[model samples]
Target: MKKIIKTVICIAALISAVSCMNNTKTLLPNVSGKAGEVIIVVGKDNWEGNLGNEIGGLLARDCEYLPQREPLYSLVNLSPGAFSDMFKLHRNIVIFNIDSTVVKQGVVYRTDVWAHPQCVIQVNASCADSAIVVLEKNGENITGAIEQAERNRVIANTLLYEESKLGDVVAKMIGGRVHFPVGYNLKKVTDDFIWIADEKQYSTQGVFIYKYPATDEDPFSEENIIARRNVFLKEYVPATAENSYMTTSVFVKPGIKFLKYHNLDFVETRGLWEVYNDYMGGPFVSHSFYSKDGKDIIVLEAWVYAPKYDKRQYLRQTESLLYSFEWDEDGNDGK
Candidate 1:
């Protein structure tokens, strides 16, 4: 009888031990959450949309990023050891904060951010600039997830004003001559970049090519540049009248030629407009002008309708974007 009792006790103890080990809670990253609150497991903005409130809900779930440009200070936010580990999981989302202050000699430099997997190749600063990342986990991750109720929130409010400013300006200029954005919004905006584009139509062709991963398309292939061709527009833009007819004209500040620009033909025309292999499509915007002859430094944008689009439906799915134009040189639009 004593031996049987002792055997029962040992079996019970073994069972309890096994249960505790099984319920110890696993340590792994998860992608789910409520609005506004960020999930720190990953150091990037994983929000679904580029702008607005619904973005808040998605933001809590993962780190989303403005992939159009290289991350500088944000990459440094995470500790080197932590960042290296996160990168192993193939994290694509990113969060970038473009904070700027005026320094001597009239220069604006962006000085900070909060993110993972970052770099600063384009900024006019050092790669060794210091940065930090903050992590917060409230409740059981998805405890208080709220839908995007605050439409007038910071992200939504800012995007509305600026997007309207750019969209309205372009819409007014084009008016009826060409099809402006049927729907538009700022998918991404920062000190260095701004993206104000929506899902709209151009010619009666199928889907526009800007709808693909721009980083992997052949700009020279007819399968691609045809969108720019299908919407054959003939207009006279009163440019600086100098490099106005060059085949490779890059008119933004500092100038990024053979990259982003339209071939408008009003008074003058130039350049073999080719979408670079790395240029991603969707949520489009017209390029910026270096200087201007009044306000009509007119740039005509061309778009076409895809076969099965739901009429301005894709207005909400832009990936990574920003707005700003700094490609001009000496106000000469260095071609």
Candidate 2:
């Protein structure tokens, strides 16, 4: 009797382990389509009706910072029955359940339903009209979640990349560390500033780090930050033409806001940048915050110049580098 009881307990434990494994498998990192691609799983009949148009208008909106027109996310529609195992692994997805029995129109947000690091939103309604209303009501939340997931992925991939020596180099010079990608290098360095850029054939992206003496505890004002940025860019970042340098465009007023990232308070600035004497410009973003020692203020700026392609993805990839900033404890090597 004792042996039989022990055998039963062992079998029960084995089943429990298997159940846990099954539950955790979907939480594994999702392997799916490229960023900005969302799979829409709905019936074919609804996909061609007014409901489809509403869904498209919500999810396929135009992205900002692009030269031409490009959807924020490309939607690939597939019938519910056809949403096979292959489609289940997508990073972002939406499903519509339009049935009379659903009673009320509603939207649901899910995570890791089929794959790890995945977002799945389901809209259920009694009819096509109700479904459209549901989508219209929750469109912003749906798109915002997708964008946040993409940003998180970018940060994750950058942190997982091999630690470049640039982090340590910057730490030694400026007392701050950033995870610069493998291709970036020190384009220009000065006593109080450093410029790092990744120049491609038709796209050029750069990040500049600098520090200056802080007078008091007053918050950085928009006018003061812009003036300082103009001075620094004029001295360090130059265009291909003679006597031309990068500066914030006066046409579009720069925007400033206070935000906290990675537990550090920073004054965020965003605006269009233009070459003073040249026909070249793009979008730029900066984060200004006080240093740990309270003696200096550090500014980290990221800018892009992609005239031929969509600047949104390029700018996002470059801007994420700023959030990777971390202060080196020992102040020796930024390892």
Clashes per model (N, Cα, C within 3 A) = 39, 0
Q: Cα deviation of 326 in candidate 1 (Å)?
A: 2.4
Which sections of candidate 1 miss by over 4 Å?
1-284, 287-290, 293-295, 300-324, 331-333
Please provide TM-scores, in order, for all candidate models, with all chains considered together. 0.21, 0.79
Q: Each candidate's lDDT (Cα)? A: 0.27, 0.83
For model 2 the local lDDT of residue 298 reads 89
Candidate 2: list runs displaced more than 4 Å: 1-30, 43-58, 65-69, 103-107, 124-138, 173-175, 214-220, 293-295, 331-335
Clashing pairs in 2: none
The Cα error of candidate 1 at residue 232, in Å, is 9.3
Per-residue CA lDDT of model 1 for 1-335, tens digit only, reads 99999999999999999999899855444222221222122223322223212223333333212112211111122322364543433222233232334121111211111222211111111111211211122212222121111111322334534443543332332221121222454443332222234544552311111111233244333333333322321111112344231111132212112333233222111122322232212212222221143322233222222334321222212211111112232333222
